[model samples]
Target chain A: MKTTAALSRLFAGIQADLDLVDKTFQERATSGLDILNTASMHAISSPGKRLRTALTLLSGKLNTYRFQKLLLLSVAFEMTHLATLIHDDIIDEASTRRGHPTVNALWGDKISILLGDYYFAKTAGLIADIEDPRIDHLFSDTVATVCEGTILEIMTSGNADLSQETYFEKIKNKTACLFAACSKGGAIISGASPEEIERLHAYGQHLGIAFQIIDDILDYTQDQSTIGKPAGNDLRQGMVTLPLIYALEDESQNGYRQQVQSLLTQTTHKEEDITAIVGWVTRGNGVKKSLLDAHAHGNKAREALYHFPPSPDRDVLDELIDFVLSRNK
Target chain B: MKTTAALSRLFAGIQADLDLVDKTFQERATSGLDILNTASMHAISSPGKRLRTALTLLSGKLNTYRFQKLLLLSVAFEMTHLATLIHDDIIDEASTRRGHPTVNALWGDKISILLGDYYFAKTAGLIADIEDPRIDHLFSDTVATVCEGTILEIMTSGNADLSQETYFEKIKNKTACLFAACSKGGAIISGASPEEIERLHAYGQHLGIAFQIIDDILDYTQDQSTIGKPAGNDLRQGMVTLPLIYALEDESQNGYRQQVQSLLTQTTHKEEDITAIVGWVTRGNGVKKSLLDAHAHGNKAREALYHFPPSPDRDVLDELIDFVLSRNK
Candidate 1:
């Protein structure tokens, strides 16, 4: 009951931080043009965890450098995250996101793409406004790293032979790198010591890995309503996440392999096929095992923060670590 | 004869500078990955005037900064330009660029999109390497403005009611802002005075506007072999460029507007319609008048540079002004 209450409190705090970032996004994109205004608002108003912004703010606070620059930097990271999401939807051919029709689904691919570009540009502009050379370099480098990671993901998609090492690298580039950047950049902007910056970066890296692993596990475990899309969608797309990796471990399961291959060969997948695979993965304990691994990562992430000065902010950071490993939503 | 010789000399110098930028682009993108090497080489091997890089180098030279920073900055701007072109081809559904199959046409839209992203990230990396706050800010601002301009263009497409003022603003953002940034940033990096930076920026602005106006005119007048794309293709897509703007001046040409409407109404466009419109626009001297306007703007661009001290580099700058206005191929 105490842990539940703590989780609730953490959720509320994150919600408030995200709301502030959304408000800032609104003010910055207030062009008089109607289409621009509508598109900008629609894109920003979507539900997101704002995890990147949280990492930025928490890291800055933990380093004892909470300031306007940190907030601006946080906003920049969130904008980049949002921009990438918008573009990713188009690339993934996803019809829905966050329990709503995607921007491409609503307005067509062209506007979705151009609007994504606009946000990327806006993010860069925001970072430019921060005006510290070290921060500027870090932000640009992070943006570049994120893009490279995305490209790596695109390259490896649907390749069944993709190794675990490459998958880790891809995830590091696509997801964890930005999280790492958020923490590292926040520390740099706040003028944290080099040691503190390194610690925060490590913390963010492990947290991101754990966060993505949980996401992959949830795809096979969560309800469709909670997942915001169909179950086993990633597997359908031939994205072999950790649970699938575990499922593929038994070379003697020829029947299972045949069933999976048959589904892969189908022109259009049926829900029953997806459900069967989900059931098999669940019965095999793949999901539960993956979750345990995620917890291990989360623990390591918290351990990385041990060198930081003890404070409430640090405590909140620890809570965040726990939240990643425990959250169901 | 003297004028022709002067023009030839200027062209030769510009070509040499373009070769240098191309070589630099090739060197920086030499990743061991075969796909990266192939894509980078394919993009850089295409023939372009390298106007943005030239502007960067020339402006830096004008301000007497003989450092490697300008070269790196020039490469960064050119990479960004190429990245946008890759994305633009996808957005425009263009099959050819520079008389060769576009990246999207040669590979696929998916690959093209990823490649464009790779270059965008690469440019950001280059900027980070420069490690200068002011240049970083300028580059980031230029990128944002370009994206905003692109969004505006997408929103206004096929809308005949779009005002000329809005069109100018869009072009200025999409095209002229980067050009202006190149000159202003180059001068600033070279430690030029405020007045000199402003003068160079004005020069870039006027030159960019004139450059685009000529480009728009060529879309109506030039042969496919020369312009490397079908003439009147923009009009076929319902884009209102300067020549089309002037052609629509007479109310009696309501028929022309109706023809445009009819063309757009079709499920598929016929080449005959494109050919007919191209003929009409050419005979009407719309292209000639547009070129004359380009010349007027080019003269204004030259005037902006009059405030600077007289040097041989200034002569080269003056020559470039006339060259951009008169170039046919």
Candidate 2:
């Protein structure tokens, strides 16, 4: 119960900051035109975790950084995250996200693609406003890393023989790198010590990896209703995640791999076939082991926070680490 | 004869700068990975006029501002432009651009969309490296404006009653604003006086309008062989350009509007019908008047350049203005 309360407090704080970022985005984009206002509001109001922005603000405040700079950095991080999501939805052929129709689904892939570019431009604009070339350079390099990661993911999609090293690199680029940037950038903006910045960045990086592992595990274990989408959707798309990696280790499961591969190759398969595969994975110990692995990483993430000075903000971050381990929905 | 010589000289100068910009882009994007290097080269090698980069370099040099800043700004502008074009090609369902298969046509829409985002991230990265928050803000705002313009165009397609004011606003955002930024940003980076920056901005704005108008005219007046694509492709797609605007003034041509509306409403139409509509618009006086209006804007563009002090660089600017007026392909 106490952990839930902490999570709520963190959520509310992040929500308020995101509201401010949304308002700033709207105010800057207003050209006294109704269409511009309407479109901007519609795009911004779409549901998201706002996790990237939260990481930026919370990390900065924990280090006693200036509020305004923290807000701007939060906005930039959120914009970059949003930009990638917009394009990713198109590539995934995902019609929905966060229980709402994706931009690509609602407006068609073309507008979604353009809007993604717009968000990227907005993020760049925010970075440029900071007036520090070092921050600018760091932000740009991070963006490139994210793109490279995405390309790597696309290239390796159906390759079951994908190595663990390749998987780590892909997840680091596609997920962890941005999270690391959020913490480190917040630290940079707030004038944190190099050591503190490094520690905070490590904390974010480990947390992101754990978070993605949990997500992958959920694909096998969670009910569609709670998850807000069909289970096994990733596997349906031929992406072999961690649970599948673990499940495929047994020689008996070699037949199971062939079944999954046949479904993928056919480009058409019954949902029941996917459900059977999900059941098989669940009956096995893979999901349980993946969860244990996630917990271990979550513990490591909390350990990285030890370098920071004691504060309530740091305490909330500590709670956040626990929340990641226990999150169900 | 004199005009041809001027254009030849202008193209030669632009070609040299484009080579340098291309080389720099390749060097910066290198990741010691063959796939990345190959993809970056293939994407950037796609055909374009390099107008944004050329404008940036010329504007900077026109003020006698000699620095590597122009190179950075030029690359940013070109990347931004290419990013938008990739998205635009998807939106327009265009299979060919500049007489070659579009990114979407060759790689599929999914890859095309991601590649566009890749360039956007790359452009943001470049701007971030420059470490100027003000310039970053400018680029971001410009990008947002371009997006809004594109959205507006999509929403307003086939609306025969679209006002001239709305058209100008759309073109300003979609085309002229970027050109203005190229000129003004180039000057700002070199620390030009505010007055000089504004004048160059005006020059770019007028030139961009002229350039777009000429393009619209060519859609009706130029043959497939000369223009390297089917003429009237825009009209077939239900886009009403300036020449169509002029053509619609006559009662007889009012039927042409109806034909366009009908074509747009249909899922598919006969090619003969499309060809007939193109022939009607071309034989009319509207296209001629539109060309004349384009020349007038070109003249205005030249007039805006009078604010700068005389130099050989300024002479090159004059030559570029003349080149814009005379180009037939």
Error of 2 at B201 (Å): 0.4
For residue B282, what is the lDDT in candidate 1? 76
Tally clashing residue pairs in candidate 1.
0
Kindly list the per-residue Cα lDDT of model 1 for residues A234-323, writing each as its tens digit. Answer: 877666677776676656544686677666545577888889888888778668768887888888888888888687778878888877
- Which pairs of residues collide in model 2? A128-B133, A129-B133, A133-B131, A136-B128, A140-B125
Q: Local distance difference test, per candidate?
A: 0.76, 0.75
Model 2 per-residue lDDT tens digits across residues B1-329: 44335455675755676678877777765664456566556667765447677788778876656557777878888878877887898888888876777777876776667666767767776766555565777788888889878877777787766666777778888988888889878877777788888888888888888778777888887777766678777777777777777777777767777776676556566888878878887889878877787778777878878777787667777777766766665
- Per-residue lDDT of model 1, residues B116-230, tens digit only: 7667666766776676777777877787788778878877777656666887888889898988998887898888989888999999988998888888887887778777887
What TM-score would you give candidate 2 relative to the actual structure? Answer: 0.93
Candidate 2 stretches greater than 4 Å from native: A1-6, A11-19, A25-40, A46-48, B1-8, B11-18, B31-36
